[model samples]
Target: MAIIKLSETKLQELKEVCKSFNNDKGELINVLHKAQSIFGYLPAEVQEVIAKELNVSVAHVYGVVTFYSFFTMTPKGEHPISVCLGTACYVRGAEKVLEEFRRILKIQVGQTTPDGKFSLSCLRCVGACGLAPVVMVGEKVYGRVSPDGVKDIVAEYRN
Candidate 1:
């Protein structure tokens, strides 16, 4: 994946975001979130920039990014897919749906397709418990999905 370099304007904006927080330690996650929002993902250079601005160590920033499930070190696809694997969904065969996605896309969980069109991820739950076996593409929610439904769902975006 290509690294997204932060522009001066972006860096300045990040500084403003950083200022809204009280301290570096407390603001790590928020800063990273803002960085991800701007750059799509948290690259090493962006970490370095954040470290300099926040007066934190690059290692600390890297550590936080790696430790958090919400952080990504690589670019995400144009359309990101997250399958719910909570107990309710899992019991309803969400795992099977995830397996189907891997079979069709040839990429495991937490990976993006080489073409950069799709990325797959897993979530503990979407809080839509009534909608077990849910697959979310971007902001849209898809419920009651089956293993066979993966292909159609993927193809819908392609078309």
Candidate 2:
């Protein structure tokens, strides 16, 4: 695949992050965290630059990025929706709730809407068993979410 070119300014900004960490190879995780914060996601081009700066193989950088669930290659929408799928949530009907979200948004899990307003994902748990079948939008949690409540929840963020 061809490299996705970033603006000159973004490259400079990324360089500054590397410089801040003193380009220490051992600081790869820290650098990646900062880089992800700046770029929203760690795309291939960003990973390439990071590898070159830290003197590591691109494969190594890619490996670390993929190993960490927190890092993402694709950009998430403004309102990222995460549904809990842990045992408690599943037993509480998270699957139906998840399906409802997919239906209303017209995008399956791991996809963002075309308008970039919402992205859908499922996590093993959010540690809220009492609030089972929960949905989190950004940092806000909506507890006890039913399949019927999916439409209103999605509409809450619609512009």
Candidate 3:
């Protein structure tokens, strides 16, 4: 992963977020969430700032960031794709669907495309078993996805 320099403005914004939570160690998770929102991903530099602001160790902040699937140390694409690998989706051919995405996007799970247009990942469930074989692009959910339909899904955001 490439190292990114955190801008002063964004650093101030992160500090303000921690301040909003009184910089309480108990609110570490909350602070992390808000920090992620500001910086997109929690890089080591951001984590260091957060640790100092919260009066905690950098290890503690890193532990929480890595512990939660919601947090990411690397940046995501403009449109992130998450495939549901839960029982329902898996049994329904989620793996094939995932492969189709890999082929079309030319990127594997947890990787963003070279053009920075899309990123692919897998999750346990999306709470939409009724709509099995689910694929989420950003906040929009695509249900009943099949290998053949992957191209069309990618096309939706190509422009």
- Taking all chains together, each candidate's TM-score versus the true structure is 0.86, 0.85, 0.86
Q: Summarize candidate 3's per-residue lDDT along 1-159 as a digit string, tens digits.
A: 466778989998999998999989999999989888897788899999989998999999899999998999877889989999999999999999999999999898999898889999999998999999999999999999999999999999999
Q: How well does candidate 1 match the true structure in TM-score terms?
A: 0.86
Flag regions of model 1 displaced more than 4 Å.
1-3, 7-9, 22-26
What is the TM-score of candidate 2? 0.85
- lDDT of each residue in 1-159, candidate 2, tens digit only: 567678788889998999888999899999999888887788899999999999999999999999998999987889999999999999999999999999999999988899989999999988888999889999999999999999999888996
- Ranking of all predicted structures according to lDDT, beginning with the best and ending with the worst: 3, 2, 1
* Predicted candidate 1 versus true structure: per-residue lDDT over 102-152, tens digit per residue: 999899898999999899999999899798999999999999999988999
Alpha-carbon lDDT, every model: 0.88, 0.92, 0.92
Model 1, residue 36: distance off in Å is 2.0
Which parts of model 2 have CA positions greater than 4 angstroms off? 1-13
Candidate 1 colliding pairs: none
